[model samples]
Target: MAEKIFMKGCEAVAETAVRAGCRFFAGYPITPQNDVPEYFARRMPEVNGVFIQGESEVASSNMAYGAAAAGVRSMTSSSSCGISLKSEAISWMAGANLPVVIANFQRGGPGIGTIQPAQQDYLQATHASGNGGFRMLVLSPMNLQEAVDMTWQAFELADKYSKPVMLLMDGFTGTMMEPVELPEPLSEEEVAAIRASKTWAARGKHGGPQHKVMCGPGLDTRISQEQMNERDAELYESWKTTEVEYEDYMTGDAEIVLTAYGITGRIAKSAVKLLRAEGIRAGLIRPKKVYPFPDAAYEKLPLEKLRGIVSAEMSIPAQFAEDVERVVHGRTRIVTALSSGGEVLDRAAILDAARSLMK
Candidate 1:
């Protein structure tokens, strides 16, 4: 049995990953997400695993790539700028179909943005996490508990799709302390089973056919291109069926829906409560997974009573709002309230936007 505790978001995610039988970790610490590695560094020794702090984000990502290629569950974490350095590595990992969980404790950006939570990276994670036409399942968690839960799921999705999975949770949502339930670490029996069942692992001493997991080999460029195309098509196809985490709060009879994710969704939820207190029929659509955005989430809303959709995000321009538009399909107007890092959108601003849409 796992113990329940109140913990920070990043810490919980780290513990969750370790408990799930992740044995390799390579990362550089940044604000908000720094605690993740700190916890792992202390906790991993108990399980006799490896925790390496690479010289740079580039080195850390490469280490993660190597670990995953060796067929062990591994991970890497970084903030916005750090994520930038890791783009190439992520692309390569996806091509090789190496499954490693990535945690991007997002914050403000464009350059080296502040250490404040922001959902602006939605484009970074959703549209093209890496370059090219490739795609990975980007799982977005809205709170501390969700952060932990989704980290485990990310590993599962990555291995299943033979691709990388990023757990997208922002700084505030990643750093804030919250209550959560945790499961006991994977047992030794489970670890032994994983090692023995080398269906796709590079177990160092193979006595069978050569197993080469590479997205691109210098010899056969065409094969690489074909694989990329196939994976891209599958990713898009999966997008329709991939929206696994989405919730509608007080939206049953709502005319206008507020769309947000991560901590911004929490803020929007508070705004919803206040709006309801004032007899405003407002609702919120909180998306847990941003990449494979939910399909037909607002199906029941009356088109006539529907005034408009409002997006509150910690980005300068609305990042999460665009996904809402993709989901809306011309059913309503789209309004966005923007903020970056420390500049959070006020509840009064959201309430006013909801009122304006009604009028």
Candidate 2:
């Protein structure tokens, strides 16, 4: 078995990014996610990588953008409001088709609501991450191990698609500690080869044509922009078929199903076991990747046999429920167990919602 090391969630993500060959990290300090930059500060130097604590979230995000443009595996992290500050740069990275990994250690929202964990940014992450209609592969890990694994994979996926990828976790998950077997660090030669592969990056001329890194279709005319949008749309659609990931736990004979992601989904797994002990036939469908949401999980469900599908999340007004409703299409009743402003979703609330559906 691989040896495991106990590590905090944020620090694990930072270390994993370094192992994945990320040579540039630029981020501003924010609650919950500050540990990410802190770890990178100490570790990046040892790895001969660059770590910049930019003056602000906006500056840090754009700095990562610049690094990624030069073919470096780059990353940035922030909390909810800080993420908002980085949105414009994120969109630019998307528009430019740069591969950059982003980590959002989500916290209570609307406007610096609190420094506590919350899934209030689901809509922002999946729907309107930026001004553009571009989409990102959003990975939501249920635990620190998954967080480390996903952070490593985020860089690969970002490079694979030439687009930004997001690791979306709440402050609860970011602050938690767990034992994880991290992936091996990339060798210096391997990192060099990866950078060499990015011929499109603006890395100066190497006895060839100079590369130009343009952002957002390069001020193209309306017709040209439309063409670019269509091409980007196809790329986004491809992710649904190739990147959708979720866990279907005890869902085979379930009458009550709980749907969630990230930390809330982790808790919901326990709720499923409790509900099963009580003979409720409860199960869980936890999306590992929320953007190209595991819609097929819902599509494959025996909707008629299910009494209710509970959308459990740490958000007010139940943002995740919107995706559930969209996928289920009213074929079965949908409910929610929600808490916001730093409050977490408890098993009792999920149980109450599922039991009410039984009534």
Candidate 3:
């Protein structure tokens, strides 16, 4: 068995990315997520990897893009505002079908709202990560372990689909410390295999002149662009069939179901346990893959027995609830348990919402 290691969220995630064969990282300093790049700054050299604290988020994003464009495993990390700054480059990478992993330790928002944790970026991360009509595989982790595991998965998924993948974590999850068993590092042969498989990646004249490029409007370019879009559409559709992941807790016979993501989901889980002990038959649905939305989990619920659905989050407008509502489709009453302005969703608040749904 791999020995367990106790580490903070940012360090664990950064180290895990290294073990996953990521050889390049470029990021700007941002609250909560700063530790991620800080760790890489020191450790990346030991692994013969490159780490650059770009002049700004914009520069860091393009640095990552250049590295990945050259067939290297590359990544970047930042908070909400920093991510906003990187959006244009993110879209460019998507259009080029370049695989890169990004980590967003989200903070309260609109425009540099707060440094405290919040899920207000839910819509931005899922609905529109960039200007193009592109989709990213967005994974949200509720705990330190999940964050570490998903960071590793993010790289693999990005390579598999040849597109950018995001790990969406809030400030709390990105700063908390916990015990976790880190995976073994990938061998050089494995890393080489990953790079070798990408025949289309830029490799100078050694691979002969490459003609594949990102979006364009010329006659031949137009035809190829349409083909690429169609292929990307199919890739996105496959995630629904193969990658939608979520956790159902005490939901078998529950009278009310609480839906959330990230730390809010973790809190709702605690509320479910408390309500279960009181015979309220409360349950929780925590989506692991936020972009895919795990709507199928709701379909499997005992809707005939369900009384209500509670959407919990650290956002005032309840960014995560929009999709939950679309899935519930008025089969039951829907209420929100929200904590804004950098506050976390407490179990007591979730408990109160669950009880109110019972009423």
Candidate 4:
């Protein structure tokens, strides 16, 4: 068995990224995620990789963009507001078909609401990460182990799809500590092979004149831009079939279901156990990938026996609920157990919501 190490979530993510063959990391300091870049700064040098603490989030995101365009496995991370600053660069990378990994340790937001953890960024992550209507595969981890695993694999997913892949973590997950068995580091030869596979990279020519051009929206002419968009649309569609992931816990005989992602999802699971003990017959459905949401999970629900689904999240006005509503399609009632402005969701609220639905 691989040895387990107790590590903070953010640091675990950083170490996992390094082991996964990421060679470049650029990011600025932000609460709940400062540990990620700090760990990278120390660890990247040991692996002969590069790490830069840019003057600003925008600069850092662009630095990651440049590295990714040059065929380096690159990454960047930030908190909620910092992610907002980096969105333009994310959009540019998407337009140019550059593969990069990004981590968002979410805090409260619309503006700089608070430094405390919140799931308010769900809509921003899955629907509108940037100016252009582009989508990225958004992975929401419920614990440190999943965070480490997702961070390790995010690079490959980004490269496979030729788009940015986001690790959408709330601040709670970023700062929390747990024992996790990290994945094995990629061998040096394996890393080199992966880098060599990117023939379209902006690296200098091997034996002939270079022909690859990395250009974003305005750089491409109208027809080419349209074609690029069409191609990207197809790639996004493919994820629904190949990448959708979710957890259906005790849902077989459930009369009430709780739906959430990230930290809130973890909490909801606890509420499920309590409800089950109380003979309430409640269950939980947690989406692991929020972008290519596990719509099939919702579709397969025993709607005939279900009383309602409680959309529990640490966001006011219910951001995650929107996706649940779209999938449920009025087949059954849907309610929300929400907290915002950095407030965390509690089991009591979820229990009350479920019990009310039962009533």
lDDT per residue, candidate 1, 292-348, as tens digits? 777567555665468888888888777777777776778788788777766666877
Worst 10 residues of 1 by lDDT: 213-222
Question: How well does candidate 1 match the true structure in TM-score terms?
Answer: 0.93
Q: Output the TM-score of candidate 4.
A: 0.97
What value does the lDDT take at residue 185 in candidate 4?
96
Tally clashing residue pairs in candidate 1.
0
Name model 1 segments beyond 4 Å from true.
1-3, 217-224
Candidate 2: residue 252 Cα off by (Å): 0.5
lDDT of 3 by residue, 1-359 (tens): 89899899999999999999999999998897989999999989988899999999999998999889888899998999999999988988888888999999999987998999998899989989988688899999999899989999999899988899999998999888899989999998898888888877776666475575443222344466678778878888888979999999888878999888998888888888888888898888999999878989998887666889889999988788889888888888889999988987777888888888777
Worst 10 residues of 3 by lDDT: 213-222
Q: Lowest summed-lDDT stretch of 10 residues in model 2?
A: 214-223
User: Which has the better TM-score: candidate 1, or candidate 3?
Assistant: 3
Model 4: worst 10 consecutive residues (lDDT sum): 217-226
Query: Would you give me the overall lDDT of model 3?
Result: 0.88
lDDT of each: 0.79, 0.91, 0.88, 0.91
